[model samples]
Each structure stands twice: as C-alpha cells, then as structure tokens.
Target: DTAVSQTPKYLVTQMGNDKSIKCEQNLGHDTMYWYKQDSKKFLKIMFSYNNKELIINETVPNRFSPKSPDKAHLNLHINSLELGDSAVYFCASSLFGENYGYTFGSGTRLTVV
Candidate 1:
C-alpha cells in the first residue's frame, strides 16, 4: 500500500471555482503538511498539522485552508480559485521529534483557466 495518497491527482477548473484536495497517510506519523509548488517550481509550505491541531501556517492567503479531521488525514481547500493558484500541491507526513524525513504523496496538479 502507498504510504501516502492524495485524491483527484489532477484537476482542471475555471477561475473562481472552489475545490478541495484530500490527502491521507498510513504511516503512523504525528505531523502532516501541505505544500504548494508554483510554475517556477518553488515549493512553499502552506500548512502543517500535528496531532490534529493546526501549526506552522506560513503567510498563506486566507483563501486557502487546511483541514485535519484526524492525525492521519490533512485536506486542503481553496476558495475563489485564481489563475495563480495553478500549481502542484503535495501532501507530506513526518514523525515528530526524530526528523525521519517526510513521506510525500504523489502531487495533485491544479490548473485554473
């Protein structure tokens, strides 16, 4: 089984549409994160959740939200998608306190046209 998995790996939608991407990890990690990669391939962390609590939210736009219903799942939601929102979104998980390295899910490509 995949250690990490994300649903709807590819999404193409019009501007102003609202969408959500789901991510789940099977590795018993205590921390999970959502990252965004722009066209320039610049990877920036959007949010991090540890043990189902929000933490490490980098100055991400208010339109973006990270929801963690549980420790193993962290989902991302974007409202009023803009053309700039088009990018690859990655979900990753890591074991707290050990720096074991994060296991990343295959990224979801979002294109807003």
Candidate 2:
C-alpha cells in the first residue's frame, strides 16, 4: 500500500493557468500537509490539516489553497500560475507531536511556461 500519493507527478503549463493536485494517504494519519520544494530543493510547508481543520503557514500566498476532504486526503489548488511557482509539490503526512517527521510523496513537478 502506498503511504502517501499525489497525482500528476509532472505538470507543464503556461502562465496564468489554474491547476489542482490531488493527494491521498493510506497510513491513517491524523494530519496531512502540502509542501513545496523549489528547484534548489528547499522544502517549505504551505498548509496543514488535522481532522479537517485547516492550518495555514503564514508565508504561503493567498493564491495557494489546500482542501482536505477527510483526514486521509488533502489537495492543493493554485491560481494564476507564475514562473515563480515552478517547483515540486510534495504531499506528506505525520502524526501530531514534536518527534513526527513527515512521509513525503515522490512529488509533483509544476512548471510554468
């Protein structure tokens, strides 16, 4: 069983287009997260959800939204894609607490032309 999965592992599009990436985890984790990994490989948390409650990272743009239909799934929606948005999107999940490190998906590469 896949612990975590995200669709469209590679997405190429022109600027100003909107797109959505889907994520699902079968680990029965209570919390799920969306993280962006830039070309330089710096990973940053964008959003997190636990039991359907949204937790926003202050640095994330308002143009990025996260939707969690259930504890097992969280999806990322991006509006008006920009070249700056070209990066790998990773989906992760972990239990709540200090010691929890996330289990990340391979990642979805979003390239804006």
Candidate 3:
C-alpha cells in the first residue's frame, strides 16, 4: 500500500464550483498535512493536523478548509474555487521527532477552467 494516497488525482472544474479532495496515510504517524504546489512548483503548507486536531495554519485563505477525521486521514475542501486556486495539492504524513520525514502523495492536480 502507498504510504500516502489521495483520491481524484485529476480534477477539472468550472471556476465557481466547490470541491473536495481526500487523503489517507498508513504511515502510523500522528501528523498529516495539506500542501499546495503552485505552477512554479513551490510547495506551501496550508494546514496540519495531529491526531484529528488542527495544529497549524499557514495563513491559508478561508476558502480553503482542512479536516482530519483521524490521524490517518486528512481531507481538503475548497469553496468558491477561482482560477488562482488551480494547482497541484499534496498530502503528506510524518512523525514528530528526530530523523522522521514526511512522505507525500502523488498529488492531485486541480484545474479551474
């Protein structure tokens, strides 16, 4: 099984549609995260959760919401999607300790047309 997996790897939608992407990881880590990769390939952290609780928010817009049902699962919801919101989103998981690093999903490419 994949360390981290995201559903709907490709999403093509109209500009105003609302959509959600789901992620799950079996890494047995306490923390999971949502990250957005811009066209320029810069990955920025949008949200982080530890054991179903929100732990970090990296100044992401209100249009973007993250939910963690459990430590193994993290989902992202996007509302009022805009052209600017088109990007690749990645889900990742990692433990909080020395030498443990995040393992990322293959990524979901969202395009608003």
TM-score of each: 0.97, 0.95, 0.96
Q: What 10-residue stretch in candidate 2 is worst by lDDT? A: 54-63
Count clashes in each candidate, considering only residues at least 3 apart in sequence or on different chains. 0, 0, 0
Per-residue lDDT of candidate 1, residues 10-92 (tens digit): 99999999999999999999999999999898999999999999988999889999999999999999999999999999999
Better of 1 and 2 by TM-score: 1
**Candidate 3 segments exceeding 4 Å error:** none
Q: Name every residue pair that clashes in candidate 2.
A: none
Ranking by TM-score: 1, 3, 2
Residue range 1-113, candidate 2, lDDT tens digits: 77899999999999999999999999888999898899888988888898889865658778898999899999999999899999999999999777988899889999999
Quantify all predictions' global Cα lDDT against the true fold: 0.95, 0.91, 0.93
**Model 1 residue 52 CA deviation in Å:** 0.6
Ranking of models by lDDT: 1, 3, 2
The residue ranges of model 1 lying beyond 4 angstroms of the native Cα positions read none
- Candidate 2: list runs displaced more than 4 Å: none
User: Higher-lDDT candidate among 2 and 3?
Assistant: 3
